[model samples]
Target: MQPLACRSCGNTVLVAKSSLAHTSVQWADSSRCVEFALAGSLTERAVVSGCTALRASIEDAVRAGRIEVPAE
Candidate 1:
């Protein structure tokens, strides 16, 4: 896993990308996510999908060579 910070909220999370279609994120404290804490109705969805801002951050990190993906 690699470390990445969300561009929108500045929350740091661990990210791992096995392929273009697969990504895994590990957060030390999910409750600390600003977006997640503000997601009222979407709380359940947030638990499953995680913060969209973080997702985009992971993608950007991958593109910027900050994260590595295994070759298939």
Candidate 2:
């Protein structure tokens, strides 16, 4: 189990690997409802670093002309 901050209420919540694969994210403080699921291939550290890596990939694809962003 690991203590992860709730994305909703920012409370420190202990989550077991089993729970990450099953139930929805329930905030200890009950602020927001967040739906969650753990990818089988993701490690805890990979999860922590996910957004940064995802953003970098998106940006790189755009810069490389692989992804086209339509004008707003």
Candidate 3:
């Protein structure tokens, strides 16, 4: 497991590959409430960075008119 800094609280939290697939994000504690499961070699930093980058890329694409923004 690897420690990842939370974007909202800046707290270093562990994010396992198993949790990414099965865990549910909680807003109360801002952390995972499950145990880690063995899987592919992915560090917490890598997962967080990938998630952040993906979100940014999607946002950028939407802003640049490369993607459509859905109306609420």
Which of the numbered candidates is closest to the native, going by highest TM-score? Answer: 1
**C-alpha lDDT of residue 59 in model 2:** 49
- Candidate 2, which ten residues in sequence have the lowest lDDT sum? 17-26
Q: Write the per-residue lDDT of candidate 1 for residues 12-45, one digit (tens) a residue.
A: 7888898988998888766667767776555564
State every prediction's TM-score relative to the real structure.
Answer: 0.79, 0.30, 0.31
- lDDT tens readout by residue for model 2, 1-72: 334453343444433323212322223432221222233332532344233333344445445654444443
Whole-model alpha-carbon lDDT for candidate 1: 0.79
- The residue pairs found clashing in candidate 3 are none
Better of 1 and 2 by TM-score: 1
The residue pairs found clashing in candidate 2 are: none
Query: Residue 66 of candidate 3: its Cα lDDT?
Result: 48
The candidate 1 region of ten consecutive residues with least summed lDDT is 40-49
Which scores better on TM-score, 1 or 3?
1
C-alpha lDDT values of all predictions: 0.79, 0.36, 0.36
Query: TM-score of predicted model 3?
Result: 0.31
lDDT of 2 at 30: 23
lDDT sort, best first: 1, 2, 3
